[model samples]
Target: MQGQNGRGTDMPPAVSVRLEVIKRRSDFLKAARAQRRGMPGFLLQARRRASDEPDPSAIRVGFTCSRKVGNAVTRNRAKRRLRALAREILPQLGRPGWDYVLVGRPGATVTRDFAAMREDLIRALRRIHESPQ
Candidate 1:
């Protein structure tokens, strides 16, 4: 499926549009813990390094897929899909000074609807943004 980017309907390569903001060592863990504190459907996880502090201006993101998801190829495909979802929806729901991490579920992310995946990420981000600070 395609997202409305105004002017016209466009399909940017998920890789081309994806922004890679590395997570620091400590911050990653903090958010992971924050996941437990999150309300329904807003848990967080880490896909990269953890930092001492969260980045004030970057929306840190991560991707993951367990062995159950599939073989290497399937895992990669799931990651690519999540990366694309983040690319399109992150900037919209993300706050200027927040971080985002995308964690993949075995079959949930890999076999799910791409459009629904897009909506899920959007809803998650919205929950994060609307959550208490």
Candidate 2:
């Protein structure tokens, strides 16, 4: 199949790329207090784990959508979009030993275009990495 860029050979394979999931509430809260970059669709919170932490080579991430986003169905939809965005962009661009939380924004998270949402995530990650701590 041809890629979105219209280059048949330029498309990447469907190989699964694995990334560690941040499941604990404390981890997400820690990342929340770290550096954050806000985009149109979501807020990207990133925290670089200390050298002494276990799994120093793993990149971990979390997804969340608040009630302000909508009802359960809408919030879940927003989280799903954020998850897809992370899956597509984080493996290559996210730095190891860092935890990232993608928090969905009200209205924008569900209404924004998918390609634009992807770009928002990419830009937010870039800003987070480039900014001085």
Candidate 3:
């Protein structure tokens, strides 16, 4: 059967498969001060948005790679990798009302196996959710 987005799928309708992109520097900084889980390929930072905040029912995400990671080309490449991974994983595992930031690490993010990076994100999400606020 075809889903709303025009892809064939067997998944239930009760599950949300959409993620909102975070574009503001302030939002990224806010999540940065919340919680972080480090993996070899990347770092995951997540924070719960206030109940009164807009679009509290959507999962928001931001991606970034610092100059330390490399020059413009490398940093953009790393961010592209991160964006792809987030698109694949976040819709399924991400919690609503939360903002997540994925920071790419030099060398590792560009070269590590994709499967490992997926696992890292999953594990990081689990840890972040289970930790006390």
TM-score of each: 0.67, 0.87, 0.87
Residue 70, candidate 2: Cα error in Å is 0.6
lDDT of each: 0.57, 0.86, 0.88
In model 2, the runs with Cα more than 4 Å from the true position are: 1-17
lDDT score for residue 73 of model 2: 97
Kindly list the per-residue Cα lDDT of model 2 for residues 20-61, writing each as its tens digit.
888999999999999999999999999999889889988899
Ranking by lDDT: 3, 2, 1
Worst 10 residues of 3 by lDDT: 5-14
Arranged by TM-score, best first: 2, 3, 1
Best by lDDT: 3
Q: Report the C-alpha lDDT of model 1 over 37-131, residue by residue, as the tens digit.
A: 22222234423223444544455676555687789998898778877777776655555445556666766777777766655665565555565
Candidate 3 Cα RMSD after full superposition onto the native fold (Å): 4.7
**Position 9, candidate 3: lDDT:** 36
Model 1: residues >4 Å from true position, as ranges? 1-18, 23-26, 36-55
The worst-scoring run of ten residues by lDDT in candidate 1 lies at 35-44
Q: What is the lDDT of residue 119 in candidate 1?
A: 56
